[model samples]
Target: MKEDSVLKKLSRDWRVVLMVALVIFSVIAIGPHFDENGQFATNLQYGLDLQEGSWLQMEFQAEVVTVQTGQPLQEIAANLSEQLDAEVLPVGPDQIEVRMPMTEAELRPLFEQAGAEVVAVNQGVSKETAESVKRVLDEKVNSLGTKDARVNVLTGLNGITRYVRVELAGVDMETANEIVGKQGKFEIRVETTGDQTQHVLFGDSITSVSTPEKDPHYGKWGVSFTIDEAGAKAFQEAAISSNAVNDPQNHELIMYLDNETVYSAPLTVELANSLKANPVRSLTATTGTGDEGLEKAMNLEIHLRAGSLPVDVKVVGSGSVSAALGDYFKILSFLAAVLALIVVGVVIYYRYREPSIVLPMVMTTLAEILILLGIARFIQQLDLASIAGIIAVMGTGIDQLVVITDEVLHEGRVPSPSVYLKRLGRALGIIMVAASTTIIAMLPLALMDLSTLRGFAIITILGVFVGVLITRPAYGKIIMAILSK
Candidate 1:
């Protein structure tokens, strides 16, 4: 009868029930299981410092400039490109991107000569260009069949992105460097008779590559690209010399990247005739129609760029961690967490001198940490900094539990149920205020890309939320049941 009453009581309390459900769900999400080698493991991922990996930080060698001009923006950009001997693109109505590194002082004179004034100059690429660079890097890394990689564009508050960082797990520093530094060599060749081919131009001759789009009239997916004047003339000459204009079926154009043929198609009748009369600067390579065509066209676009960034990048920093060292760090992290919990339990026991109070407090805190880890398994990878945050959370959690225990056990004895309820409310109010302050303090660190601190801030914030919303309230109800008994 007493066991039944206890079960009924637990069922009556929604807080206790919710906590029980969450704990079960957390255990499942963690997915602890035996590996093929009969070793115990969970679905938890570790970051660079806690796993074998290599990291690289690269700085973009480009500039974003604010300009004031009376002439048309395109005309000013063209003139500036000519004088500076570099690529210039308009990013906004007043903001232009200079592909080459230049200081404000150096750019001012050039802007004036081009009928424009340099209002401001920042040493980085614009946000759009930075995103493009990130995309290209992501594609390059994924092409290597790397399962674990992270690419981040670090942007400043002024909207200029200055650096990009890449982290790859299970890779050595040398291989990582080679992957980032390598560039694909793209070439176009015209087929003469049989298997004979003549070189037309290289990737350097290509000025720009556009995203894949469908031709509305033909319902075909293709990427459009523009070539320089010299490339256009060379392409026209190659076509005429190969007699591709008159015998389109017999002659074909092949595109190669790194000496491997990626695309081969006979020139269209219209394109052949046009090349005979004039040099074509703009050309389209159609993949085909429907979803498969769109996918192929996207790949072709990446091939056209040849793994090149719009802005140049210089490796600013590089590092690697060996697997043995990473194992040591992981062991240290686990020891730290265990040591922290032991310390908290000892300190709380010294204050209360009661096993009931100390055990529940420690167990509740552990539950909070478990839920945090379970959620992080899906969203984040644990690192040294995040582990530190978890330890800090344990400390804070014990403090809050102390507040609750002292409040409810006022006058050294369990109070009436009504008084216990009032004290619990007051204790929760205190916890809410403290949690809000901690969250607010960590907000900037979490939101801003402060490098390593970002992970710490985010983990701390998540811990606080889990404690306040889940474990703390459940602890309160469980303590009430224990004390009333």
Candidate 2:
């Protein structure tokens, strides 16, 4: 009857119900399942260290400098570009981005020649250019059909992006380099004689490239792009010179990216007649109908943009992990986490020596882990460092539970209902203070772009938050119910 009464009181408690609901929700989010080969898998994503992959850290070859110039910024930028033989553009008020690496000494003279005084020279690209580079890399990686990829821009404390890192899963260092090292160079040429072709224009002439679209009438897939006036005139001149305006079928226009042909199609009769009359600015490269056409059109869109970054880059660091080694690390990480939980449970049992108290503490701690993993599955990828953080959270969680147990059982005796409530509140106050301090300490690491350590810090901070917010209060309510019986 006492046990039944305890169960009834616990069932009525809202805290325990909330904890249970969260556990169930977490399990669903994790979505653990077995693959066809009878191997376990889940929606949880693992980092490069926990899976087969390669990583490349690349430094942008660019600089941002403040200048004082009486000449128009545009003129100075163009003159500086011509003098340095590099891409230079105005970024902000009195600031310009030179898309090449150079020391302050080398830049000062050039700025002076361009009628500008160099105030400061920073060895990194501006934030906007960095983001543009990231977008281009993202498109290139996606076009290659890589399974999982991560591109992170590492900015210094001075708010300049010096390096960008790319992580590709299920690939080697060579393959990773091939993907990120070469920037696409797009060219368009028109077929002349038997196999000879005449150059129409380079990718620089392209003004805009749009997303793939389907033709409503014919169900054909195509990518539309607009070219500059010079490009249009060049295209018209090429068509007239190659006799393509009269014999459209014989004179196929070919597109190449990185010296490899990507698209070839003859101009339609209407387009040929339009080119005969005047230069055409907008054009569509049509692929065949269906899914394959849509896929081709998508790739064509990326190719048309040339996948060119605003600034050049140099690979500074790279590494790779084989599938076998990754599997070994994954197993070790699992074992480490299990060992931590077991050791914590044993210590808790020794301290309390009572099945009721020990069981609730262990169960509560496990629940905390579940909620943490569930939340992490959505926001962060699991890695060896993050697994270490999980173990650390386990130890800290047990300590907080012990504090609660000792506080409520003051003078080695179970407290009355009124006394228990007061003690629980005080215990909660202590836990909150400790949680705040832990969060404060981990905030910098969690927020910074410190690569792997960021994961560890984030998991630690998240674990602390889950414990204080959800599991601890529930454990307090649950322990009170059992002790009252």
Which candidate number maximizes TM-score?
Answer: 1
lDDT of 1 by residue, 398-475 (tens): 889889988999989899989999999999999999999999999988876537887799899999999899888889
Assess the local accuracy of residue 111 in candidate 1 as a C-alpha lDDT between 0 and 100. 83
Tell me the deviation in Å of residue 9 in model 1. 2.5
Q: Estimate each model's TM-score.
A: 0.80, 0.78
Stretches of model 2 off by over 4 angstroms after superposition: 143-145, 181-204, 207-230, 235-304
Evaluate model 2: give its TM-score. Answer: 0.78
> What's the C-alpha lDDT at position 108 in model 1?
89
Query: What is candidate 1's CA lDDT for residue 407?
Result: 91
Listed per candidate, the RMSD to the true structure in angstroms reads 5.1, 7.5
lDDT of 2 by residue, 225-291 (tens): 8898999999999999999999999999999987889999999999999999999999999998999
Q: Whole-model Cα lDDT per candidate?
A: 0.88, 0.89
Query: For model 2, where is the 10-residue window of minimal lDDT?
Result: 444-453
lDDT of 2: 0.89
- Cα-lDDT of candidate 1: 0.88
Q: Which residue pairs collide, candidate 2? A: none
